[model samples]
Target: METTPCRMFPFIRSKTAQSKNTELTVNGSSSSSALYKSNFNLGTILCAAAQDSPQKTAIVYDDKIFLSYKDLDVAARKFASLLMTGNYAKGAVPCRPEDRVAILLPNIPQFCIAYYGALYAGCIVVPMNFLFTEREITGLVKDSEAKVLVALKAYGTEPTKAAKKLGIPILWADDESSCGMQALLSSANPLPALIPTSPDDTAVILYTSGTTGVPKGAMLSHMNLFLNATIVPNTIRPVEPDEETIVLAVLPLFHIFGQTCMQNTTFARMGKLVMLPRFEPGEVLRTIEKYNVSLFAGVPTMYIAMLRCPESDKYSLGSLKMAISGGAAIPVEILKEFEQRYGIAIMEGYGLSETSPTCCSNSVRQGRKPGSIGHPVWGVEMTILDEKDQPVPDGQPGEVCIRGHCVMKGYFKRPKETAEAMRNGWFHTGDVGIRDPDGSYRIVDRTKDMIIRGGLNVYPREVEEVLYMHPAVAEAAVVGIPSERLGEEIAAYICKKEGHEVSSEEITEHCKRYLAAYKYPRKIEFVKELPKGPSGKILKREIREWHKKMKSKL
Candidate 1:
């Protein structure tokens, strides 16, 4: 193998040039620069890193399987060969460029192999949540029009059923069966080279959480994901020359937060990734200490669980350099307490599946803001806009708008919705936020999640922030419930800490002291736990369903 210069920090400098059939732009006008290569493929990051450091460990799974970069690259090539030659299963056809390949797996090594393999073959990769049922899997697969499905053997039943119904072949990983991915890899020859792909070619199709309606697949191009994976780390805190960056991959790989920020970013820097199939507070701490992890990223709820873990202090997490929080608005109270307890700064960022998931982040060099999402990274422009699509002044709340190299091309097969979101050359985020005079942004709440009671607007995040301050509260979700008098009344669902109990009246009184009459939750319900998505974000949609059931009973 020829040695390739490790372009660890491609965006460090700026140059504009033209490649084969496309224009390449590398500019330093923004705080973060853009690196757009016309003849580029996302899978090359792994191949280049492997050539640069073949013997270095790339992935450590469950602290048992340690895969070197060379081994991982070879495995990805074998899988690509399987896709390109139509040798995986009966009735399978050779995949063409832009073909959709669905992946239904967890945060294991096979997920990485299959993901990069599909990209190497110049196919669009579609990742699905492993927890989805057969119905959910079938719906997503059918919607994506995927030519093939790759899933773990343990979770293959539902995906296989979906594949059969859709007339697509399913490849099982980690199975001793004759049809498993390993068996096919043993019989297939490694692809000699990665298929050429243009920077604008769609590389991934990430589905949104669909809080408003049906989930839409966001189309991210090679340039979008590549720029985000490289720019975010340099903008926030670049890895030092002598330092070894080890990332703990507890966040679900299917989610954008983990896929781009954690997995792709680690590969871009030639760092080691420690994979955990699921998030358990105790197991997370143990893994971090055992592997001497330097970087960690997770949602707000993960931090809350780790803070509340009784055995968290037993592990000396001195190696942790920083932690990132996203996926939701983290309460200021919890952020402060966790930082004080663990002595690690939690840098909050903001992005969506459409923005390659890392547009705005609190920078280490700029100093940390307690509640702000910080400024836009290099190559990204963010502003607050009013309902008229006009930019709003500083300190005023409006819809957050972003335009950047990291933004997705558009939603797949939904031109109308795409046009609605990408109006005025900026993507309307649907999130209400305020911008500081210094350019920092703070999330107010989602426009759909805001509650209006008696002609006054109430943001659930503000009330939930106060609720998190309660000593006995472990987790809290605030929502707007139906009311005959007011348009919508505030409701709080509280999950108390273990061995601690608090009444609804006590919780209401605590909120009353801090919030106004309409801002405090009028009805408080104590629950054992709150519904969370794959990334451990509190799901208000589920809570709303519970409220509907309770109202029907009443």
Candidate 2:
């Protein structure tokens, strides 16, 4: 495939101009001046697209609900009007500018309408995972201090229960019920215009995964979401002006990867989005073939499932132009196999919820490396820094730090945590990585996931990557288990492929061949499947907890 050098933005110096030893940061800024705009609204992307292409199909859901750009815009405006007027039901209060409006729904059309509607009303959007229980919903609602919630009745009574407990009004979006979003939209007039918003005002409060502890809301400003949504697509794919870009939305829209990269990016380009409420490998493959999906963005596990689907050979995924991976580090073996089989490039990127979720990515325009999360996106600078926040040399592993237009405002209502994370003007991502000689970055592992056995440090990704190389290994997660002798011993949880069998000793020997004595997994346990989050990233925190529970029983 043909490739170009990474684009250099006008506002920042080129990576080549900086000394690799003194400043190991890679800059992926382009020459677009709009990136530094002062006043902007996240909702403007949808409005602008609607104005430009009123008849264009904006979203296609399950081959049933097809929304034109104008239709989508009108629905969003109506929803915004309802929020502004507080006329949806009794005891409802008008949502003021910057007020948090939580949304608990799946990847349906209602999610898009509510998300943009909240922003159009100049309200901060708090997108909650629909899978969250009543207690989890209440905790997030209390933390965000959300004024109202837009949820689906089909998701059950949890959302309503949480809203009632908090004394906040909840709007239901049930297609089957009369008291749904459609009824509310029909009764309410369309909002004439979007509320004026400053670029610095928080548009969305995306809570962290809370893998370590309590989830904190990351305050993403209009500018942060705007630039990231604009840069990532232009850098990676660069859709033609007249080209029809069709995207598959299987990843949960509540996640930053799906929100900014898939939804917002597609709208900015006047592209069509095919929505799937849930990801079943067969359904995803069938949809891709049915819609001629040109772009797909998902977590690593999503790719693995589609690749391993038993009847995958029947589907001709020729329309797929590129596959974007994020949310977690994809095993290199899976990346290579999927690419070779599908005849498409998988561009892996890296970021946290705090960075509006995309700081670095492997671009088609900019040459992509297989295992590396390519250079920083346009207007972003990423560098590996030591514990003291000093720049680390190229090829040396350190905590990845980022700064530029895409960094979030701060953790909502948590000044001390924000201060600690944003020390020295750079948002310190707890991910350990090494800067490649070619200006790309490779994630080593999470700082907390690193295991110290005897006196040697071992990255679980390194072990997991090797385990993925084994033929019978269908999925693998490596975690550190407490040890009385070695501080912590490396433990591997694996899922084997169907009709294949592999002993723990065989898996151990496979790792021993590639890894050092201290780095290899000392304990191996086979399971039917590994636990995954909403976006399909493996949940190491849950695995550790399960291990603890089993140990107590022993």
User: How do the residues 1-554 of candidate 2 rate in per-residue lDDT, one tens digit apiece?
Assistant: 11111111110122222222221111232212232444479999999998898778888885766777877787787778678777765688877779999988899888998999899888999999998999999999999999988887777688878888999887887644445566667656566567778999999999999988899999999999998888667887787677788999988999998898889989988889989999999999999999999999889888888888996788988998888899999999998898788888798998788888888999878877988999998889999999989998999999999999999999999999999999999999899999999899999999999998898889999999999999998899999989988889889999998889999999988998999888898889999999999999999999999989888321
C-alpha local distance difference test of each model: 0.85, 0.84
lDDT of 1 by residue, 1-554 (tens): 12221222111111211111222111212111222324599888898998899878888885557777876777787778678777888879988779999998899888998999899878899999977888888988888899998887787778877777888888887676667776777655565567788999999999999899999999999989999888778899977788998999999989999999899999999999999999999999998998899999999999999988988898977899889999998899878998888898899999999999899999889988989999999999998999999989999989999998989999999999999999989999999999999989999999999999888999999999999889999999999988888878888899999989889999989999999987998888899899999999999999999989877321
Model 1, residue 260: C-alpha shift (Å): 0.5
Give the residue spans of candidate 2 off by over 4 A. Answer: 1-39, 175-178, 552-554
TM-score of each: 0.92, 0.92
Question: RMSD of candidate 1 to the true fold?
Answer: 8.0
Which candidate has the highest lDDT of all? 1
The backbone clash count of each candidate, in order, is 1, 4
Structure candidate 2, residue pairs in collision: 9-29, 9-30, 28-378, 29-379
